[model samples]
Target: MRNGNRRGKPVEKARHFWPTTKRLISYLRPWKWGVLLSILMAIVSVALNIVSPKILGQATTDIYDGILKGVQQMKLGLHITKYPIDFNHVGQICLIVVALYILSGLFSFGQQVLMTWISQKVVYNLRQDFKEKMGRLPIKYYDQHSNGDLMSRMVNDMDNISGTLQ
Candidate 1:
């Protein structure tokens, strides 16, 4: 009564249809915050801190070429009252530039803190949900599978998720 050229046994088909992945994805709701935080941190780290330095450097170059050079030219002219500008005021301007560099570093530090918070929170919630779901599944199910396989899914998969977040 079975099909005409069946290659494998019915039991083999049953063995291949494991339900681990579908079961796991159902419990991933609470970890969204961590995922969002990770994306935010990555974007901020790349865009703000990295890109800002190049932009600031260009701005500094413009100031040096246009304003600083103009001041030098004006100082050399006899009509100083008409084009009054000081070249000896580099001390205060240098301090301001240093402060901007410090501020950029602070932005990077803040992003790291946010990323760590998200990664830890997501991994903790994911582990907790995984354990809870595993506990609820019937014991008869475990009888069909190896303990090592079950443990690998519970521990190793979660560790992989956390490592990936990093």
Candidate 2:
């Protein structure tokens, strides 16, 4: 038999999360633009990557078709297309794809930097509020509570929260 009780542990009651989530969102309301811009850039990046495959495929198809046309005209004396392979056009498409991805990466990087700034500002505000609350609390409250526990509540707990956010 196991040393400990067979029943592992008691299940805790589940807490409703939406209200807390809404409160957090309310805190972020001030930097709505930062969050919104991050989301928008993410959308743009996805769009660019999605369109890239099609453009690349077009360039690939052009190369293959041009090769086939050249072979047919030379071997069978058949004219598939009047013009030869359009290297210039394929080169332009490749350049466009590269530019689009670069822009997407830049936007994504900017969004991450902006969001990091906003999150730090919010964290600073929250910690400052906790400090202020500690100052305002009654002397009796501190006298009754363990100093170490209270300090941990203020510092360690907040650090945990900040870590979770990050």
* CA RMSD of all predictions: 10.6, 5.8
Which has the greatest TM-score? 2
TM-score of each: 0.50, 0.71
Write the residue-wise lDDT of candidate 2 on 61-150 in tens digits.
989988877887878866565547899989998999899889888877876777778777777887887789889999999899997887
Q: How accurate locally, in lDDT, is each candidate?
A: 0.61, 0.78
Evaluated at residue 118, the lDDT of candidate 1 is 61
Residue 142 lDDT in candidate 1: 84
Per-residue CA lDDT of model 1 for 1-86, tens digit only, reads 26433665443243333474454344444656655665675565556556555655655665566666567877687344433333
* lDDT score at residue 20, model 1, on the 0-100 scale: 47
Q: TM-score of the candidate numbered 2? A: 0.71
